[model samples]
Target: MFTKILIANRGEIACRVIKTARRMGVKTVAVYSDADAGAMHVAMADEAYHIGGAAAAESYLCYDKIIEVCKQSGAQAVHPGYGFLSENAAFCRALAENDITFIGPPVGAIEAMGSKSEAKKIMEKADVPLVPGYHGDEQSIEFMKNEADKMGYPVILKAAAGGGGKGMRIVWKAEEIEDAYEAAKREAIKGFGDDHMLVEKYLTKPRHVEIQVFADQHDNVVYLFERDCSVQRRHQKVFEEAPAPLMQNDLRARMGKAACNAARAIGYEGAGTVEFLLDEDGSFYFMEMNTRLQVEHPVTEMITGEDLVEWQLRVAAGQTLPQKQDDLSISGHAIEVRVYAEDPDNDFLPATGTLTHLRPPQESAHVRVDTGVREGDEVSIHYDPMISKLIVWADTREGALRHLRKALNEYQVVGLTTNIEFLATLAAHPAFVNFDVDTGFIAKHENDLFPKREHITDDALALACLDVFITRDEEAQAQADWSGDPFSPWHSTSGFRMNDDNHHELYFVEGDDIITVTCHYRDEGYVMELPGGDVLVRGERDDNGDLAADLGGRRMKATVVRHGDNLEILVHGRAHALKLFDPLAAAEGQDEVSGSLTSPMPGKVVSVLVEKDQEVKEGDSLMILEAMKMEHTIFAPMDGVVADIFFNAGDQLEEGVELLKLQGE
Candidate 1:
């Protein structure tokens, strides 16, 4: 076994590799960019090195810097955890040139699977099932359009050299093919430096199931069953599970053999995944192969009782196959959800800010959290905005899903928006519970997933009010301590009355409306007067921030997390956001700013499609901005003529910066 190996990546995957390496008694080295100076992975490594600037291009993608670190640290091997240089064939060759082992599939395997066009050719020769589409070398827009026309409507364009939902587009009509082609090409070049693309027939309601295959230097390959990655948004997997639900044993064996065939056909080594698009008719077509550890490998690990990273290390070290195909068996169901600091309602746009509060579900045999951040850490816009991967395992799929929902309920983060509630809703969806999964699950069930929340019940309102009272009393006690006057009435907010019961009003804003709840202290508790009815409530906050209380003699528990002026109260698996409403501020109204279009998030202007004084209809594209590695086109809000354009192509912009002005006709 190697004494040491360096992880040439950052964030969760990097930290994940280090933990397994540590368990195997191998010292690990970690590399970090300026943005990740205090990142969790760096602090966990036995040795760390500064790579470059905050951006990935200046740091993680710099092949020479990573190679230099390997030599400086005297590491025997380097693990390029998915993304970054993981699939870079040239980088693998460079490590071989320097006598440092690259703990992944050989350069031959990576190069074979690097280009979707070329990989399809290899699969065709191996007799692997492929979708009916064009996978060729022609790079012309007209050629792609012609091919798409022949393949019929609803063709999906994918970058030949990229994955992870980048450089991909689905066109439902011939007229939409050209714009999608150009956009996909631009994003492909930005992501993989390769504009080469392939067109595939988009299947309706197809489930994305992939087999985890492993091989070694001895040419021994074995399939580790499969993971269903059908739950997706923006063509990216949101939820992944192993031993895919509703899969038959015969189908599993066939897919497993097909995945193994693809691996062996390339003379593959190390960990790799062969993805397939399972159609409604039980026919499966080949999707591209990922020649590195997948982001959702934990699900596979949980079901098979295997450490894939450790297996990768062993395979790279010239060890024999750990076990044959027969020895490995799926024992239980596993599920993983990618918790991102992004808005699910707003096209999943990535959000950047400090994590004021990061409290995830407690990890046990049934639950796990894979992350590389801590409380107060900043979620930067320079890289993937993933918060963590929440994984759960159980004896059955239903039980695993139940655990998933429970874990999501306990998970909490503040200071920025997240997809936690969105995930919880997805977990409990009827379609999902009944195994109605597909690549278009989110789009298919939009209304149920993003439902408009109803107003809080009397109990929730009472809890919110109870929390307010608890906070005020704590503040009063602290003030009394500072003043050295325990009996000071001025510091108290009790609404004390000698003759009558103390009465108080608490105002809170949910969404855009203000709510007023009146309360009267009586009988050692409080009676809250709501629009619906009166309710008696008594609650106290526990050390763990849970509200243990009674609402009209009904006992319940909930968590109210406060950050700045916002309060996120989770009640009965539903999260509600409430802000303290100040009536005085509302009375002094301020004029709203208008007449200009502003940037939604910090990004660089990719293009300006409109000119000054140019007439535009509502929903016309005024400009496009690239941020968090995705392009967002700013559209006209109304029929107008462009009066002024503020930013130009390639110019950096902060959030809320006015991009262009439009004077209505």
Candidate 2:
């Protein structure tokens, strides 16, 4: 085995490769951009080097810099971890020219499978099953439209050089074709620098199942079963699992063979994945082959008991295959959920901020976490927003699902918004539980998933009030007249009678209205019996005069203050700011609260679409903000005029920052 290898990537994949390299007694070198200077991957490697700027193009995509780093660090080989320069045939060729091993497929295979159009041609020639579509090099708009017309409506426009859902769009009608084509082309040029596209017939209910294939230089290849990546949003995979839930023995055997054949046909070596689109009719078609390790490879590793990165190094070192096709057997079911810094309720837009608190669940016999970030690291807008991959394995699919759900519940991230709630909902969905969903599941059930719920119970309100009252009573104890006021409710323990008759009114907000509850003290704490005959538990004040209470089975930390005849209790991160009103004063101080549009997260303003005083319609793109390497367009709240623009392009704004003011008339 090589003594040292340079990982020409960053994030969890880089850390992942280092882990296996270390296990094999090989030294690992990590390369990072300016943004990743203090990243977790850098800390995991034996040695680290700075490559270039923050953006991938200046750093991770700089093949020359990576090669130079490998030579400087005396790395015997370089591992491209699935993105950036992973599938670049020219980069692989250059590595070979430099006499440094590239731990991936040969250049010839990459060239054949890197481009979607060329991959289609190669698959067709190799007798692999293919979908009916136009894979020709016709770039004219009219030609694409005519091809789409022939393929029927509801076709997909894909960038010839695209992956990871970039430069792809689905058109459902002729009128949507031109706009989608233009958008796809523009994004393609920006993302991959390739405007060429291919039109394919859209499979309405397709399940994405990919087969893992490993090959060596001795023309030996073996398969590692399949992964079902059907859970997706915006064409991006959200969750994945190995040993597809509904897979049959015959189908698995046939798909495994086909995947190996495709790899062999391209003279493939090292770790690669052959992706397929399985339609509702049980027919599967070759999608494309990824020429490097995948983000969800942990699922395959858990089921097959194989370290694919180690296999890559061994194969690159010219080792023969260690096992034959007959020797491989899957052991269990493994499922992986990609934890990202994104908000599911906000159209799944990427979020950027410092991760003030991040605690992934500890790994156990059934759970593993692979992450490239720590608590203090900033989630920048220079790269993908994926923070980590949570993988769970069990003897059965249901067991794996249950394990994954429990792990997700224990996963904590405090600073930025995430899709944790969404993942929980997905796990609880009946279709997902029964494995009856497809790629379009999110789009079909978005309405049920996006709305935010505010579930306030009467028990919670009572608990909040009691918590605050205890805190205030503790503070008043130092000045209470407890010498001879036993019956006056101020002469018992802690300067307040434990068995007194005192009444206090608490006010809180529920939705748009305020609710007033009256509680009378009985024991050490208030014991107002609910009309439904349910009991409530309240806590005592701590040394700091703060009370903690269990309200409706939910814990609450509250601080209570009293002024004159009004009682104020702070709960759930809000200050309440309530006013104590006599029945006569309440009628005189009733007014409605107004609403305003605020920035949902921190990011940089990319473009301001509307000028001051401009009239805009609802759903119109008011401004575009770039965050976490993705652009999000903020829309108008309602039909209104732009009263003021508080921010312009290049302005750095914080979450809840007022970006604009609207006037409704």
Best by TM-score: 1
lDDT of every predicted structure (CA atoms): 0.91, 0.82
Off by over 4 Å in 2: 456-665
Q: What does candidate 2 score on TM? A: 0.82
TM-score of every candidate relative to the true structure: 0.97, 0.82
Q: Residue by residue across 42-69, what tens digits does model 1's lDDT show? A: 9999999999999999999998999999
Question: Residue-wise lDDT of candidate 2 within 97-181, one digit each (tens)?
Answer: 9999999999999999979999998888888899889988879989999999998989999998988887789999999999789
How does model 1 score by TM-score?
0.97
Q: Residue 4 in model 2: shift from native, Å? A: 0.8
